[model samples]
Target: MALNRYYYPTKYESRAKVISLGVKCVFISHQQNDKDAARKIADYLINAGVDVYFDEYDGDLRISHQSNNARAVTDSIRKGINNSSHMLVLVSPNTLRSTWVPFEIGYGYDKTDLSVLCLKGIPKGSLPEYIRTANIIRDIYDFNIKISNVLEKSQSLLEETKLMSSYANSANPLSNVMDAMINDPYN
Candidate 1:
């Protein structure tokens, strides 16, 4: 999957600073019928220090014939997906009947580096066709672990990059001093 090639510094310019800031956001996709489950997941993530972009909380619900509200909602969803580091789809039996869920998944896969399928109240053998190909977390424990791992990995990579940069900048001077004698063989 394309997620295998996911890189942090390429996405954010100030890699070390970004990691140190400790702010990770996730856009959640789910059917309106599954709002209760979705809300629970959002709350859990929030308590775990993740910023959640949930449509019911962050989207417009008012409908107007004069205004293009549908388009507005789509734009909001797209922006949310684009801004977030990860997109998590809450998969339930109701998800199979949702038209928007598929669109959200497709957009997330195309636009974001990480798109996770979180199965809720469903059997593993009965997963939908679209969900069958995603990075899936079967339970809340796995979901928590997955998010924690992603954050930890990103922070670790940032620390490694910072160390490498520091070494590259400082080691040249010492190397040059050592090589001074070699360059001036007569000394």
Candidate 2:
């Protein structure tokens, strides 16, 4: 919640224009298996004019991971975190088995405004110890509220996007993953 927001006057300003540093850029961290779901979240944010650093579109990160080049991949993740003002850790069943997700969380914990976005069916009790302590976005509505707070947007604006209706009655972006989740979030 304590994200460092710095705004500096542009040196080459056409009249003392102020520029914000990574104002609403969000770094999305999710397991490889959850790429599709992550993309949906990213798309939703993008539609709302938020900058997102989803690894799915990072060619360098993809090549590094495919080559098993841990150093390169780590560098890419670090760079992504450095450029983002916020971090959204997408939590699902697959997240429990991920090696990189934990690292991302740890690295970005102090660097960005971090929040754990749990998929539907993931109980508060089932969250990992590290994640259990952070701000949690339980469902799509909660996500909308928390993100809108960060963006300083009105609920009316979100409703104007026509996405809220799609997410009504469990039609959320990660509805498939949410539906596939078992009663037990750990396993």
Candidate 3:
């Protein structure tokens, strides 16, 4: 219920270097087994110029315990999603079984842009309902594409970027104009 102030939208022109607004992002994954992979995903995003607000890298914000920790973990993930513009959910077999991950996804539903990247072994069939709706990527490279798209939708600032430059130059100028007028006046 707290207001989120950390989400930032990046703007990039077709030929111009991508300019990041330093958006705060949250990483959600299995704590015990997927922690290392979570760090790797965070690192990849960081290297690509997006700021990451992962619990593993940020702090021990996510609570730990057996049953009682559920509320605390949910609260922590909610706060993270609330404060972040985007979420990077690492999907694996372990991730699919995680109750907290679904809670996190539920907290983020229709609230923040979400990107789900599955590790090599994770099955698409095992994905939870919330994450199943996400554009699934097999690896890190595919993750970047999904992330870019999610970021673009969330920001409304990357439409002009080369990644989606065609959208800006689409045949439907009316829609673009309306979007510019309604969603992005400066763009």
Candidate 4:
């Protein structure tokens, strides 16, 4: 199926400083059933020094279980998905019919380039029909490899962007305008 493309930066006008700080990510999936896997992935990313946003921690503090904190969790999840630069989707059989998952994927689809990890095998006789034609990986092992590849690409881009920004900041005449304003010779 066709999916809507998200807003990717066409040209580097100013500088994407936050982007160069590794992959700041949000995990979008069905939280109620995928909590364990979500937590595992989040923890893995955390240990890898990637900032991860998951819905499990978004709800009411008093509500111990995530099942009891739907409203708050959903709001937080929406915000988190919107704020994140990248999304890691956990796709499975149950995920196809999951109303929330598609919306989450579509949210990422509208906002940014998404990296999807299909923990389960792909469906036969026509795809899930809801999700876009996403690049699928067989399992978490493949997912980890894909994540590694994406991370490497992101890191390289980050470094390149950093250098470009550094050069741009130094080369641009506006740099002097701001600097001169700060270090006023008139003062």
Best by TM-score: 2
Candidate 3 local lDDT, residue 17: 31
C-alpha root-mean-square deviation, each candidate: 18.7, 7.0, 13.5, 18.3
Candidate 1, which ten residues in sequence have the lowest lDDT sum?
178-187
TM-score of each: 0.63, 0.79, 0.59, 0.56
Evaluation by lDDT, superior candidate among 1 and 3: 1
Cα deviation at 45, candidate 4, in Å, is: 2.0
Task: Report the candidate with higher TM-score, 1 versus 4.
Answer: 1
In model 4, what are the clashing residue pairs, if there are any?
A: none
Candidate 2 whole-model C-alpha lDDT, 0 to 1: 0.71
Query: So what's the TM-score on candidate 2?
Result: 0.79
Instruction: Summarize candidate 2's per-residue lDDT along 1-187 as a digit string, tens digits.
Output: 2221111121222111212432566889999888888878777776656667788767788899999999999988887777677899999889999999999999989878899887756765778888876787776666777667767877667667654323454555656544323333332
List candidate 3 segments past 4 Å from native.
1-26, 29-31, 58-71, 147-187
The whole-model C-alpha lDDT of candidate 4 against the native structure comes to 0.48
Error of 4 at 36 (Å): 1.4
Number of the top candidate by lDDT? Answer: 2
Model 4 TM-score is: 0.56
**lDDT against true structure, model 1:** 0.55
* Ranked by lDDT, top first: 2, 1, 3, 4
Q: Which ranges in model 4 have alpha carbons more than 4 Å from their true place?
A: 1-23, 60-74, 120-127, 153-187
The sequence of per-residue lDDT tens digits that candidate 1 reaches over residues 12-129 is: 3342443466536677888888787676666555544566667664424323212667677666566666556677887767888987778888887855545444443355467676
Q: Can you list the residue pairs that collide in candidate 3?
A: none
